[model samples]
Target: MSSKSSSQFSTFKDCLARRLISTTDLDGPEGSDDPLDEFTSYLASEVWPALPDTLYTASYESLSSDTVLQEMASDPFYISLDAIPIPTSFFDTLTSYTHFEDAHDCIRFLRKVLSDYLTEATAPPPVWKQTRGEKCEICERGWVRLTYHHLIPRSVHGKVLKRKWHTESMLNSVAWLCRPCHSAVHHVASNEDLARYFYTVDLLLERDDIQAWKKYASKQK
Candidate 1:
């Protein structure tokens, strides 16, 4: 990349960082900004690191980390639309290095991160006392048996042909939500709000600070 190109790329990165810090959501108008130029420029400048070229086959726990999440939240360049902050650089790195040719892989990656984090902390559900007869984590209801909900929507992975869960894909992700609460969180929160909540949860889970997490979650609701 020429100096001019490098400068432009830096500008995009700065703008994206600003957006991550300031924007509440990504959609319609805000989501359509050109990231291709930024990504190509980054690659050319060799600012981006080499990706893991093989499929990320590690278990979910191996890739997820509360520390990574805290870093993202504190980096001033993250807006959570899902549990993971979406950025062109992330996807580009995936495609460039790992076996992330589809949406399924991406979604799987998201799941791995969140699930692993929860496992590491053994953090109880946000409403553990309310759980009865196997309450679903996502829904916060006692009626149905619980299944994991990916904070990042699976729909985004529609393009993957034969998707499977792999470690790289799931790293720095979240799981353990019942279906309803999961839906409420994903569907209701704006991107920026989602990012904030994810960060809040990381902090709360790490410190076992349920009260603080509750305060933030309640405010979002």
Candidate 2:
């Protein structure tokens, strides 16, 4: 148990140190460079011990790691789930969660995070950047049609507004993309997660999956 625990914690810390990985994308407190560290530390110490020993029928003593997650899940705003240990449950696809839980889980989670969420390196641009209609920003392939997609998905607008940091216009932000790349984005993440995280082109491009898809799309007709 000790060896496994040490390995798990180290894997998490290494992922946190990545250049492409950002704390803001993880829904960490704003301006925090060490969000995961602080987040997990809180979970390990404070939250783990604070859960009620008994809830309805379940019994939780001293709030161990096992019990805290169950408590957190029940809380509407538990400050989000653990990103450390890299959650396979967060993903939705043809494959089962267990498919990603092997030795590959760590890198797979990093790839998932980079593709699915948005991070900030600077402030939002002064004006709305129009989604390109003449061509697709992601790929060189000529298309029969170009679609304008919400740079920040509209479905999550209601949730995003609750935060009060972004304007409605920002939520309605658009980006022109080819059919394949457009589909790619939606597949990579759910609408609400995208709105909560990615709202910019740079953040979109930084995704490893998007980068890979763009490379393939560029070569196609």
How many steric clashes between backbone atoms does each model show? 21, 1
Estimate the TM-score of every prediction.
0.23, 0.40
Per-model lDDT: 0.39, 0.51
- Which parts of model 2 are misplaced by more than 4 Å? 1-131, 142-144
- Per-residue alpha-carbon lDDT of candidate 1 for residues 93-198, written as tens digits (9 for 90 to 100): 6455445676556445544443332233232234422333455433334555455544333443332213333222432244555444455455555543343334
Instruction: Tell me how far the alpha carbon of residue 166 in candidate 1 is from the true structure, in angstroms, after superposition.
Output: 12
The Cα error of candidate 2 at residue 2, in Å, is 40
Tens digits of per-residue lDDT for model 2 on 8-101? 3443334334522332234445687876555444333322222232311221222243454344334423323243342333232102312433
| For model 2, the run of ten residues with the poorest summed lDDT | 114-123
RMSD of each: 19.2, 17.5
